[model samples]
Target: MTEEKYAGKNKPALSQSGVRWLWLAALVFLADIGIKFLVLDRIGYGWGNRIEILPFFNLLHVHNYGAAFSFLGDQAGWQRWFFTGIAVAVSLMLVFWMSKLPAREKWNNSAYALIIGGAIGNLFDRLVHGFVVDYLDFFWGSYHWPAFNLADSAICIGAVMIILDGFRSKPE
Candidate 1:
């Protein structure tokens, strides 16, 4: 194929790349922040203020000071900046990767965009609150899972999509 065919309508390489899907990232980021702030405004923090929504779920405002599942949340400090740095670095790297992929690579593009969105969303929280805001709560019988927010969910979903993409059959 000629450069015209690859670039499409005289667009630049970056514009023709999977970066087109960045709108999805922006959407996820906006939605994540909107809900987080709304929760912050309406819900009182901690388990004692949980609002049960189902037999297995609840809306419980909480704060995570570390990585996923509160990996080092108990630390006096430092983990906050550490995770923030990771999020910033990962978001930038994914955006750059997306800019190199062809627009047709929707699967990988979307995965990258989702992760970028989620990473930036949490980064925003970390910068603004010094912690990640979590609200969704799920439990089974007497076992309760840690509360997490939409940003966390987006990151998990994006990661799962990337992992599943590895199993997809490639074109010859």
Candidate 2:
């Protein structure tokens, strides 16, 4: 909680100028989809088809029918709509949240924008392809991290920023 004096600056004021952040969000979203398009067009879907860039890094094509880490990926297919709905709702909430931030709060705006963009990108895939396209792959010896894409990266960064924003907004 913030003290009264500090709370004023942190309050959600519903400013109209917050729309500017939407541009960044759109850019992020478009870029994510664009990369997916390139991957799908250029790379074969075979499991063994991947480009190794380093000892632990690769660009591979994958599809996630579930949420993060392929959780619920084995369900009877309801997860497509389920996760899509969640992403849609979260994206809307983030936009509203952005609209309430102070117009000059660039960091907070950027954070919200990134989350919204990532959400929209994944949601689009769920609706159109019934799965989210993933390409980036990392591994260590026999353990491999789940494949992911830019949207996932953006969402993670945004989530961290939001957490940082919380600490920064605390009363001094």
Each model's lDDT comes to 0.88, 0.85
Q: How far in Å is the alpha carbon of 100 misplaced in model 1?
A: 0.8
Off by over 4 Å in 1: 1-12
Per-residue lDDT over 24-89 for candidate 1, one digit per residue giving the tens place of the 0 to 100 score: 899999999999999999999999999999999999889999988899999988998999889989
Give each prediction's root-mean-square deviation over alpha carbons.
3.7, 3.0
Estimate, for each residue in 92-114, the C-alpha lDDT of model 2 and write its tens digit: 88776666555576887898899
Error of 1 at 78 (Å): 0.8
> Best by TM-score, which number?
1
Q: State the lDDT at 61 in candidate 1.
A: 85
Question: Top model by lDDT, which number?
Answer: 1
